[model samples]
Target chain A: MNNSKQGMTLIVKTVTRVTVWLIVLYGIYLILHGHLTPGGGFGGGVILALAFLNIMLAYGREATQKWLNLKFLEDIEAVSATLFLFMGLLGIALGGRFLINFLPKGSPHALLSAGNIPILNILIGVKVAMSLFLVVWVLAGLHEEKGGQS
Target chain B: MILPYYIAIPLLSAFLISLIAGKKDEWAVLLSTTAGASMLILSIYSLIAQNGETFVYKMGFWSLPIGIVLVQDGLTCLMLVLVSLISFTSLIYSVQYIRHMDRNWKYYALFMLLITGMNGVIITGDLFNLFVFMEIALFSAFALVAYGGHAEEYEAAFKYAVMGALSSALVLIGIAILYSATSTLTLAKIAEKVPTLDPGLIFWTGGLFLAGLGLKAAIMPFHAWLPDAHSSAPAPISSMLSGVLIKVLGIYTIIRLYFNVFNAPDFYMQVFLVLGAVSIILGGLLSIVQWDMKRLLAYSSISQVGYILVGLGIGTRLGILGAVFHLFSHAIFKSLLFYNAGAVEMALGTRDMRKMGSLARVLPITSATSLVGTLAISGIPPFNGFISKLIIIIALIKAGAPVYAILAVIGSILTLGAMMKMQRYGFRGETEIKKISEKIGWRMNTAMILLAVLCLLTGLMLLPGIRESIVDPVVKVLVDHSQYMQLVLGR
Candidate 1:
């Protein structure tokens, strides 16, 4: 019955509010530059998921729920996966083998240099991010339910 | 081009099922059934079209050795057919079976994903790719086994997950060791390099692979989790686990790696023979004591798998033939038996044999189909099991392993006694009047009946024409190791 006790203390919340956006921006950068940089979709996706987790940690379940709907997250995960598979099938449809890089490759280090690699990285990043978010949401929901009961 | 569809169709369907089904059970059923049926048709077409030749599909147009390639040969085609057939039947059965269960969409989604993983495992030509596909199939199976949310289901699933994770770790380590030794991840390249590897490293890598895959296949010493997991899972899943999953992920991988990639020495074959013999005796003896119908069938799977291993271990062309034939026959009859068990459970609401009896009067289709399955599995004459068992015994004699030949015969007798006991206790007594309905769903009945008919008819596959077209090429793939490398690597 103590509404004030929902999230962390004020100092942690303040720090988290400032840092989460920065972390998310970095994750997007990593995914966008995945082909040229060391970090790819999986690594960047985990970071993005962590950014969302930081919000949940600092702002409590209610705020996090409002910001990121679980159903929407699941939809994103499914759509991204289908998109990735479709991209692979595109090669087959285009008179090549499955998962073949069908697009023309530009020069290295350019924004759209690696053809399908960047597109695949973005799709995988979104899928992995949503999948991890869903997992954390479920586990946290279970913890909340158990806490309320006890 | 067609080879990739085996993996693509299942993967696409899994995502589509999840995306569209949301909370609708009917959509889930329709989507999954369509996926399963299409996969079955595709596999059959590929089997007929490819004949005995090997076809390799390079992913992303990357040439052989560097990019991931999907290889379709006689063995792969046979496995693809078996996986799709069993998956299709199980999906049909699940339409009615899981209707009442919550989150049926998730079940269908995981089932599709599991098929994707199995198909991928059957076709991939890369060592690391095999590990990835194995994990996909395994993770899905772990979830499916625990779908019921019962305490027993959770416990069994946890044990299965732990064992599966350990085995996967070992497999990864083996792959790492092999890669470090050979400097390549392609299976064909590894096979070419295996000849010059350090003896100690080869011994270590081979031991790791055998133990890891042995655990997956539930070979005797490493089979502790199978009974609990298989018995606790839903019946359709139990059928998948027993009929095709173990064969694809465990035995198929072992045969491919040992005979082709590693060219394992004679001592390893002896090890396989001994392990097979022990599992035969132990799995059979254990099944005879189980009162739970599903558990009895689960234990029997171990025993049947033992027969396949022993046949393969004999290391002759005929022996491999017998093993491949037995694998095919076991897939048919075992899934048939499991589906029958599921139907019985659906009608009677109890898996305990002692609780009800003489249901043959009410459940005529289930009883008749299960009778056929039981007869085939127990190696009665004119049934498929008998032909495969006979070939294996003959092969053992030809290979000059009379002691193993005798052990195999003894295993057959044990299997017969156990199955007969099951029939007597589960189906032959006075009918019990229960609150549950006696009429099972037509979909379940259709799946069981089709499998039962397949069980009876599969014996003709031993005829020279059928054998040469289907089973012989698989046998040759294993017996002649050089052919695998040559086919994949183009000499």
Candidate 2:
């Protein structure tokens, strides 16, 4: 877990880094396949969490916080919620129904199969990612506060 | 057509509140209050004239069997009114309740978000939409509960968040299973296709769905998070949480699934009847021993919800009628009680009954209003609770469930006992100001009094004509669950 290990320990660290990258990539792969396959925003988001977790575990909370500022994550979460709401509202304006699939229904088994489904997946991924990310950070911060209290 | 706005106003307000978080505190209050008030008015208007017209807004104008939709019917109208009314009252109460809190913008922002979620759940026609709205509402609620960040509050919020996350995950999995089976997401479409589903899928998914929604509803086994979250939140939020959140999230969702989607099967009713009975008796028994005032009210909500579930579960016209009536009555009076609790907590600086006495002398409006609310909820004669309780008991006997009737009567007495205890310890006894907490503003007093007046008057809505005009449509929606599809998507 330290930064200065060498030889076999360095090999172990390299393997861990590669494994974390694989997990993160796999999550995105699942998310992209959401509309046509069984995976979705939730699955992809969890995978992303694993990737982030690896980063934190490898470096430390401070390194992670530097790149993932709490304010930015909070904004992303809010914006994602707003985006989903707007997407639902857009269907209303389009004259079909609330949340109707107005986009071209790509071939059922194709990559872009369900109109809005892909959009929904992307939004869900971002929303879930930001939500989970911020929630984790907030929880960690709370722990620090609690530790201080005692 | 107008179904979307049930969620829109609160959501828009939340966005606006956040955008203007630091600019002007007064503007944030005005904006959220206006959003809440507008929703309140719209819901009441919908309640009165919402019959015979089913509004369906298909997402993106997509054809049937494929698109997500928002369905607004009589039942939706009832819940919409209940949610907005309670939300409005709570927002009003919070204007003064949360003055001491530093982050006013974040508080109102979350409040708006919670309202949006609750409102959306009542109106959405898509199963997936239901889950989405459920997450939005519960997530914001978790944040609000932790707003105070006191050790106890944080502990409760964390517990609540963990349990809430589990339920949401279950619900998402259930929706995925449902989607896999039906290949469609609209609620009416699901209702149409669900009956023909394979029995294994029906049983398993149904159980999953039930467990998921049941946890949200806090019925018996899934109720572990209720006491802590309910007791630890700010008083206005405590009012909203106990008064309306559980009903919208748990009871309403369960009823919608049972009646519209699942056809009110015997097993579901049986489950509801038993849960209702147990919650009523158990919650009542637990409340009697609680010395903390808001905690007592929190427990009382579980018992009250039991009454609603039992009434709705009876499946008779009288049963449905009694259930919806009790729902409206509870939303009003319970909120009134919370406002009273908030007022006392403000003036007396304590939620423990042992620390308060003869409070009526100093806080006349709060005491008088609380007295009215206590009488109403305890089923005293001429109050709203009595009428609904009577309807439920009569319906129970008519449905050949005589034992439940007896138990309900006993529950009523227990409720009466608890309220009497609140009355004696909280207001009627010698005024004991062991410690001064803080000064309460006029805005707080006005909100409590307004709700108390409504409690006293809403009972008159039980008159036959008023019942015919107001309650019948909502009852009919529950009774005629199978026709919801036809109504929403005309044949």
Candidate 3:
């Protein structure tokens, strides 16, 4: 019954709008508890990106661009990657070896037991989420660009 | 310590540039060049400070069976130095050269990743680690090839990616087979255990490597993608591809595995000889017919690499020395020539040699540098190419391979002819001056001049004192195959 020129029908949009927050929450859970479970940064990151992809498909690109610009996403990607690199460098400063695990390992099965691994997982998750978003969005929009390529 | 930085610095720069740099690309240029400069210094420092001593750095304090290791020996040092030097020049050249490409910071970012991959491949002592690093290098290379956003460029990049993916799969299979058979992923450990494996398994593993790495290296039969991919990239990138990338990804791994790990088996040596001779002659002949300036340079790279393979296939001390020296010299001269090609293309907006002429009047520096490059590639006297080629031919005669020596001379002649054709048509022609789309910038000129000077001076690497200190150590690594195992594994 939906007759919109852009974006999907009412049912698809409604389902996506309601489910987006839950998908993202699940992704955050995956990243935060990465050290304790099977799902880590990459697995969680793909799930997080899928949330955005769903939004893009349901609400159209122009609508998504209004709330989230590609440039901001890129900045997020860069910052997360830099932070990850900084963690590795900090390893050298603290332990005299590159990427050496200098942080204290807490008791087994605890949420924060694996020292810097959870921190790294969170960083990688954010970076991967941003990259997938950018790549997919750009490819989708590739056909619309005029001859500005030099 | 320095070995880690070789991988770390470039990866950090790539991330930082994307994070911090603005739309303008000035910071991108500054940061990349600084990174390149530091790497060059660090590589030189390691080479001199170690003075041929082997240094192995264990990752995260893990032992050989469990963790990755970075090993730096004479061969690694030579490659590290060569890579850093060419990359520094290419970065300088790209500062002004890539200005017209709209989003230039991304170019720098990808380029840094390419460097990181190459440095990783050079320093790593683990087998699977090498494959990982090779992928990093190849991925960036594919992106850079299609950077122009042209239809043909995309076509070329697609072809390269397909070939590269197939090669990677084959390499993975080879690594898997070796791992299953030997139960070790450390290269030195594999070398120690390989002699005891079933001969049939060894044959399959070696053949898989020969085919897989051979495709990456673009030997005689597997050379379809080199010309298109090399010619289609941005000029500085083309220089990087033809100059160091092929050697790093293809030739270096081949020699490292075949000689150091496989102990230069007789059958594989025969394959090297036949492929080397065929690529040399056929590549030279193909290059002579190319009307596109960069395309001809691409074909020429195949020929030059063929010479290196021939030297390696000869399987003697003098022959291996010739191979390493030629690899060194070829990196300098070929890059210089590609820079000249890039500069010419930048000015004219065309790569067709038929459309170029009288550039000597407008682009004096490019002309002068290109002449040096042409001479060096053609094996003329006083240039590094001549000495290296002479050594190879002499080694061939000494090794009692007179027929291959004859073919080598013919290949050299064909190279000379192709290079002269390039100079005559592209620089010295009487075609009236055409519209100049871009002016040759100072940075580009500086890069060309730097490489051109090195083309004449690198032959000094063979002098008595220098040879004792520099060249001998590298040759020693290849001559004594067990040295890699003993030095890296301490067995």
Candidate 4:
């Protein structure tokens, strides 16, 4: 089960350690700038998941599991989803429409201009990122249950 | 005003359970049940309060041309109420049933997702939206069917998923074609532009839709997946799959598109009639030979669905009346019977009829409730099925198709014989039963009892005054689908 936490060779591990943060930064940019650009929550989230997945490849699943539990990912994933729904419900609770842009429209093509959209995008990005990571982690068979049925 | 809550509460609670219902199964049970209960109330209230009024909710404050829409008509409202009521009962039943699998939270989460998908399908006002919601429903259904983690369950779920994917692809192609023809995704907008388009476009798109959606409904020809998929799922899920899933995905969408979107083309109506007759006989005959209790019920579901199709095929108001009413009655009674089947399987640890006998003495609640379901399904004199079937037969004769009327009668006889087979060998046989576990919990019995009582009570929906208030608007909405286009667009 690779309990000693060994991963790839020195070159690959060094490359991943160096490049992973840039990918994370790029994913965050996509999520935050989703309202102004094409890369919204979904695209950005995939990139983030890929970054973590790269870390898993370089550092080994056992090391990743030590730092990042799937249970935490599941909880955060669900929290992000619930937060997204609450934002929609927030629209309804305000006595306006169900999912109206109730916030102030700052301006066009700006970072904070699209009232509720950027926030919703951020929530979706968080959810997508965590959900994707959890799926890949489980499918990778790193979290095998004890004597579980197939 | 409350239209959004139909989808909102379930979607919210599904995630909330995963977030907050941590570790303890009881918390998951409590949270989801509250969500399901509120949903049921909202649906029933919608049926009464909407009162033949149509409501539309636009997402994100965008107009209909640009934003997605959620529409609540009489038909949609009726289905919303039906789906919610059935799901609520099933959730109650699953509280104990899922404990055996040791994964209550996951099951409840998936179940809530299922309800969300169904509610979304019933409420959405766009073609692409239906496809998206349909996928949501099917995905969860696939997972739930395989929740038992057994080899057979996985095989059945895989088969169902493949068929589901194929049907969805056809539906997507039709939607893409429609978008190309009309350059819009809203159903009413497509209807507005359909008459101005070329006839060949309509023909191809309509054919694709029928083939795709027909597979979902398990009509006579495309019903290869129903028996396995419906029979293999856990009991409550089986009830939901057999009871509401087929109707909403298959029959409901077909009715929506064929009648409202396409303007009830005479050609499709004839096709529905012939196919409906064929399904009745085919499903009936096949059901008689099965010994697996759920499998027999599953086959019988295809036949029961056939009755709804035949009713709709008649195209008269009386025919539509019977069709819609049959849909309601069939949903209740069929789910009731599935619950009984599930209860038997739970208690006996087997689904084979040969191994079960004299269960009426042991599982008395299930036996009693199953009697109501059987009579209601078999179209006995006093139950809801008899009234709906009689209405359909009378409409068939009035439509100058006496041959179809006789075929309906024969289908009835076949249904009776098939159900009788189950009753005789399954619960009333000479094989003495022993060693029943305390598997049937109060919640399970409560769910069965609720649906069984409704099986008999739903016949009152046939009474003249109540019919006008409850059933007539749904028929009017379906029969005159052009009115649907006008109403949605006009609003």
lDDT of 1 by residue, B136-175 (tens): 9999999999988778898999999999999999999999
Q: After superposition, how far is residue A119 of candidate 1 from its true place, in Å?
A: 0.8
Candidates 1 onward: DockQ, in order: 0.61, 0.29, 0.58, 0.65
**Candidate 1, RMSD to the unseen true structure:** 2.0
Provide the lDDT at B12 for model 4.
85
| Candidate 4 per-residue lDDT over residues B331-434, each given as its tens digit | 99999999999999989889999888998778999999988888999999799999999999999999999998999999999999999999999889897786
lDDT of 1 by residue, A1-150 (tens): 123477888888888878989999999999999999899999899999999998888888887776677877888899999999999889788857777788889998898888899999999999989899888778767765532211
lDDT of 3 by residue, A1-150 (tens): 124456988889888878999999999999888899999999899999999998899988887887687788888998998888888788878877677888899999998788889899999999989898888888888778763242
Q: List ranges where model 4 is wrong by over 4 Å.
A: A1-5, A142-150
| Residue A63 C-alpha lDDT in model 3 | 78
* TM-score comparison, 1 vs 2, better candidate: 1
Residue range B126-221, candidate 2, lDDT tens digits: 788888888989999998888777888989999999999998888788889988988888888888887798877766777887788888877777
Q: How well does candidate 1 score on lDDT at residue B101?
A: 53
Candidates in order, interface RMSD in Å: 3.6, 3.8, 2.1, 2.3
Task: Give model 1's TM-score for chain A to 2 decimal places.
Answer: 0.90
TM-scores for all candidates? 0.97, 0.84, 0.97, 0.97
Task: Evaluate model 2 with DockQ and give the value.
Answer: 0.29
Query: Which lDDT value does model 2 have at A63?
Result: 56
At residue A85, give the lDDT of candidate 2. 76
Q: Which ranges in model 3 have alpha carbons more than 4 Å from their true place?
A: A1-5, A146-150, B101-103, B432-435
Candidate 3 similarity to native, TM-score: 0.97
> For all candidates listed, what's the TM-score of chain B alone?
0.98, 0.96, 0.99, 0.98
Instruction: For residue B318, give model 3's deviation from the true position in Å.
Output: 0.9
On the 0 to 100 scale, the lDDT of residue B464 in model 1 is 78
